[model samples]
Target: MKILDKYLLKTFLITFTTVFVILFFIFILQTVWLFISELAGKDLDLILVIKFLLFSMPRIIPLVLPLSVLLASIMTFGNLAENYEFAAMKSSGISLQRAMRILIIFICVLSLVAFWFANSVIPYAEYKFINFRKNIAQAKPAMAIAEGQFSDVGFYNIKVNKKSGENGNILTGVTIHEKPNNYGENKTVIKAKDGKLISSEKSSILKLELNNGYYYQDVTPKKYEDRSKLPFVKSAFKKHVINIDLSELNKVDTDQESVASTNGMLNVSELRYTLDSLNKNIDNEILSFSENINQRVGITRTMRAVKPEQKKKPLPNNLLSLFKKNKEKLELIKTASSNITSTIYSIDTTQKDLKEKQRDINKHYLALYEKFVIAFACFLMFFIGAPLGAIIRKGGLGLPIVFAVLIFITFHFINTFGKRLSQEGGMTPFMGAWMSSFILSPLAILLTYRATNDNGLINFDAITTPIYNLFQKISKRFLPSQNPQ
Candidate 1:
């Protein structure tokens, strides 16, 4: 290895390490702030907290590492250019491309490492993080309930106006909505003036003792017309005690859902497998629906034993004439109308459901492609930053940081927008995943070519001189700058 390569690599690595650590810490703080509701007042031990942070840290690498590389590359190269080292190298017959050769090799290796990390480590961390979240409330049964907002613990949605006592066991004006199913329909509500929570870690039950409360259970009639009555069974109690199973709380589902969705929790291989099943599920559902619709319409059964082609003349405009009786004709019309309404409803419902399933398919494809996106992003950022630094010729934390931040923000915004659009079926998953890279890649190439040939970001003389001459001629033609000069 040449001395120049060694020095450049060392300088760049040092900057990269510093930037990575700082940015990672900043992002970690943001993570902690985001989940503060879960952590604060939970009486969680340090070890659990550390585990939570550790599990969350890996997921931030994709965001942090790219920004780190961009900033570090800019800073290192900018400093060298500012110090005239790059100029000296250029004078010594070392082109910008030659100077970047060692770093290019390093970036290639980093990109591969990034791909491996995204496929293996990030997915593992995501899986573990989801599990940790599911189990977090179990650490403290009381922790499951927040003071102001409704908290889902077990089958009940619990809210407390205020909680007092050392362990926040004493609740004032508590309201509980008990959901009998996972889809969040609540048939039972209990309100208490005061309550106390009693729990034991070893036991899977949390006991709630309430005072001066009312229990209201809504009842629905089987007849649709009677539904508006909204009959509910209500009872007042001087004191009541409810036992909630902690094990059931562990079964609680979130948007990511029981860790079952695994949208971001699967490696590329597993994603492909899951995606295949999802596609098959959608196809089978459509097929089954079609068969059901055909049967409902009675198309599969011949309406008449004789074929319609046997008719010598056209049927009467009054098709009901064949029925012979007005009552029979009216009944047939009513039945047909009802069937049409029902079929329309079925088609609309199925159409909406199919759209959601298609979105799910898009999400899986996005997840699969994201692993590769992270890898490519490393190369993208490096090419952009290295050449940009050479062009700007500014060093330290000032201009380089500004340039890196603006570029990274643009990349991040486009990436987020593309993913959202893709999820909504606005674009293909492949396009959404690579959109930011595609937009910025040409800039990378342009900057590299310019820097290699000792060209500035723009040929100001070529542009300004033409504009200046045009303005001078315009002035000479319109209003001569006079004899004042």
Candidate 2:
């Protein structure tokens, strides 16, 4: 290797490593803050907490690695420019691109490693993290229910005023709200003065025993007037036991909604397989629904067997006239109206269901595209940072840090916004995942082209030099200059 190449590599490596560690630590703190509810006051073991954080730490690499590369590149090149090292290299017939050759190769290699980590390592960590939380919640159901606030655990939102036990199994002033079910309302509520959570190591159920509690369930009436009275079924019990399935202990602990979306748990090939199956299932469902609807409104055997009258007559102006009695005509109209309404309702409901399935499919596509995005982000950030550093011509922690933060925040914000919009069916997953990259590519190209040509970020000297001359002329015109009086 040439001396210049080795020097450049060493500088960049040292900067990248330092920036990566600092940024990783900052992001890890943010992660801990996000999941503090699950970790704090849960009576969890120290090793368990450490394992939880370790599993979650890998997910931060995609964010941290890219930002670190960006900051490092900017700082390294900016520092060289600021210190006139680039000036020395340029005089030695070394162009900016020549100096960056080794770093470019290094970045390409890093991108590949990033892609592998996102595909293999991150997914495994997500799976482990999710399941680990689930196991913890199951073993200690109290973790799922925090004191003072209602914590969502499967079908119930449970709140406890106080918990006093080694494992926080003994509760006081318990309140439970059953989520909406067949009743279509969260009307079932249970309150107890004292409660105890009982669970066995071998069992997959948490038995909550409530003492001196009242169970109240709303009973909706068919008549609107009767509903206004708000009738309810209330019963007082000396001791009541509610069995909760451990499997449904709110599988989400870290993310917005991980359990409902298993895309995080699957690798590339697995996601593709799942997507294919989901597509097929949706197709079959639509075809089945269409056939069923056809049958519902299809012409029956009786209609096919009907014979035409011997003498053809003009149809009546009013179809109701064909019926002998007015009452019979009214009955016919009512039946037809009800049937039409029901058919319309069925179609509407099916359309909504199909839309939901499509959104899920989009989420899977987004996840698949995300692995590629993180890999490409390395390349993207490097290009932007390297050229920007050369162009800015200022270095160190202050200016480089400011620039890195603004650029990264823009990239991250756009990426996050696009993902959310894509998940909501605002755009295709492909466009959503690559939107930020596309938006930033132009800046990188512009910077790189200008930097290669030895152009400044802006023609600042042209602007400033003219202003300086104008001010000098104005000063001479306004006041007499006395050299030696």
Candidate 3:
């Protein structure tokens, strides 16, 4: 490599690394804050928390890497332009395009690396992260119960007005409603002033100790003779103990392969296969429904036993005979009307289902295209940031950071809006996925062109010059006496 290429690459790499680390940590902290309530007061081990954060890194890296590239490119090129290194290079016969050659190649390679991570590492991490969260949720059954909300715990639904104590196990003003079993016809209700949950790691039972409670049992009569009177039982107790089975809650699936399929957890090949299968199913359903509707309407079946040409001669010549004939046909018309209504309703329902399935297919397609689109965005962002830095001729965290954030926000907003539109069938999946790229790529090219020619970041004079001259002319005509001096 030439000395200039080496120097540019070195500076760009240093900035990229620093920016990547800072953005990654920022995103991770944001993720932690989002899940703080679920993680806190769960008596979870520190190692488990660390593992959760580690599993989350793969998902966060994809979002961070592009922004890092943008900021680093802007800051690196900005510094070069600010310090006159770019001018020196230009004077030495190295054009802006020539200077960017090595870095562009580097960014292309980085884009491929980003794609590899999205295609491989991200899917695995997404699957593991989802299952790990489920495991954590199952491990802390008591934590799932929040204050002032009813939560199902085994056969009972329990609600608490207040939860205060270590590990949030102590409950106040508890209300428990026991669901009826197969043989029972009535529900049992229990209200307690306070309660405490006690469980051990190795035990399969969670025991609830209640104080100052009343239990009410409803008894319904079995025989008709006793139906006139309703019976119930009420009992008051200072303390009550309820044991809940925790065997199911403690069971975590060890096989990661058994995790349910999600769009975010599938690679391109899997998504394609799913999309194809869904489309085939939808087509077959539509065909079958059409045939069913045809048969229901008797379009393909003969309603009369005799052939149309072999039927007897018509006999409805008088009013009485015509009335009798019409009466017999009325039943047939009613049956046909009912069948048509039902068929229309069935077709409407099936069409709705087909639409939902199509939306799911669109989601899969969007996800597949998103991986490649975001990878390409890294390259696009560099083109934008590098030239923008040269044009602005400023360096450091202040201006560059602000510009990068604004550009990225616009890109992200367009991408999100397009995805929503595609998911709702308002736009094609490919177009929706590539909308941001299409919008930004031209801006990048324009900035690169302007920067290469030594033009200002924006040509404000071209627009403002005409307006200012027009204002001066209007002022002179309106105030001629004052302008004479």
Candidate 4:
């Protein structure tokens, strides 16, 4: 029994890891290809690009690892079923639940690792990646160009034919090929007679000045004779400054109101702050609305009672009439004053509302923190995989791969949809992210039971047949009444 268990576990681990690597590479390559064109003229070093991609890996791994586990498990189990290994195990008195007990333990450990990766490692990697890019953007001007190299300046590809040191900066004969504009196929090439590079550490600006340069405008010629000569462009001094905002380039903010490191990752403190601010704002708006309503009512009453003629009357006479006729107005003024006091009270209540909201948000964060159980999904894959193997009774890649893909697709879709909704404040982040796996736990158990008992996969055909028939009947009933023939 021990030998058999070791063999199955080994096979599962090998296949799972191989497939996961393949999928990871494919995703990484796709991302790199999509962004390569944008980096064409930019002085992005190969080493830096590689480092950036490496740093980004931690962020994506947490997302992909679970699916990889699902796929690997399904395939592994499907293979076991095909080979009758599960049947043999059953014959030897090893229950499906007993076999899966080991996997459950494994899952628990993996879950903890995933939790740490998401809440700590990934966020730190993201922070460093952003800062590195910002530093690259603000690096020295001379470092921007390499001799006999084609470098990108924003959207333009520039090459320098010759270089010499002049006035604390590099001087060169420059060739710039600007990328296509909205109106043209491609930009005209510019050959500068001479150019100078300037850099300042205090300001994130690289200055390039060119002298005695002629330009050719690339546009569709309207007349036949107009195409006779290229547009004569002469410039005495052409200076360009590439302004880079180092601060905006990086997403992390290090300031008084900036999120602290303890609250930096998907942690409780930041969420609490956001929730508290929103609740306070809502309370303030509610109070302001009440104040506005009272003010409006008071002004309306005052307007109705007071007249132009009354205002022009003798002061005593006006005062007497005001007393007689404007008693309602006076009462409204008093009521409004009371409402204003209530508004003040509401302002005081805002702190309490904020605290309550902070507490609620912290509850969610704490819930996620405590229930780090979801991290074990990697190991849970084995339970789903091993039993699925016995049930399918298929071995090689074909059937296992298909089953794995179907299960993974479903899981991925659920997880992603939930994450997006949660991030947009529609759902609790912890619940949204883990809901799919939580729901699937029962299904895995059921599948394992059926497989262990030698019962076949559920008869979906019979279940669907009735539903399809009902749908057909409903459609027929709803159809527009045909002419009685």
Q: Let me know the TM-score candidate 3 reaches against the reference structure.
A: 0.76
- lDDT by residue (337-414, candidate 1, tens digit) is 777867876788799999999999999999999999999999999999999899999989999999999999999999
Which stretches of model 4 miss by more than 4 angstroms?
37-41, 140-376, 379-383, 423-431, 460-485
Per-residue lDDT of model 4, residues 391-460, tens digit only: 7777666887787777767777876777666655576767775767787787778887777677778778
TM-score for each predicted model, relative to the true structure: 0.83, 0.77, 0.76, 0.55
Score each candidate by Cα lDDT.
0.88, 0.87, 0.86, 0.62
The alpha-carbon lDDT assigned to residue 251 of candidate 1 equals 47
After best superposition, candidate 4 residue 413: deviation in angstroms? 2.1
Top-TM-score structure, candidate number: 1
> Lowest summed lDDT over 10 consecutive residues: which window, candidate 3?
221-230
Give the poorly placed runs of model 3, Cα more than 4 Å off: 143-246, 253-257, 301-345, 469-485
Model 3, 147-220: lDDT tens digits are 78787677888899988887778999999989877835336899999999888888989999999999998776
C-alpha displacement of 259 in model 1, angstroms? 4.7
Candidates 2 and 4 compared by TM-score, better number: 2
The 10-residue segment of model 4 with minimum total lDDT is 249-258
Candidate number of the best lDDT: 1
Model 2 global lDDT (CA atoms, 0 to 1): 0.87
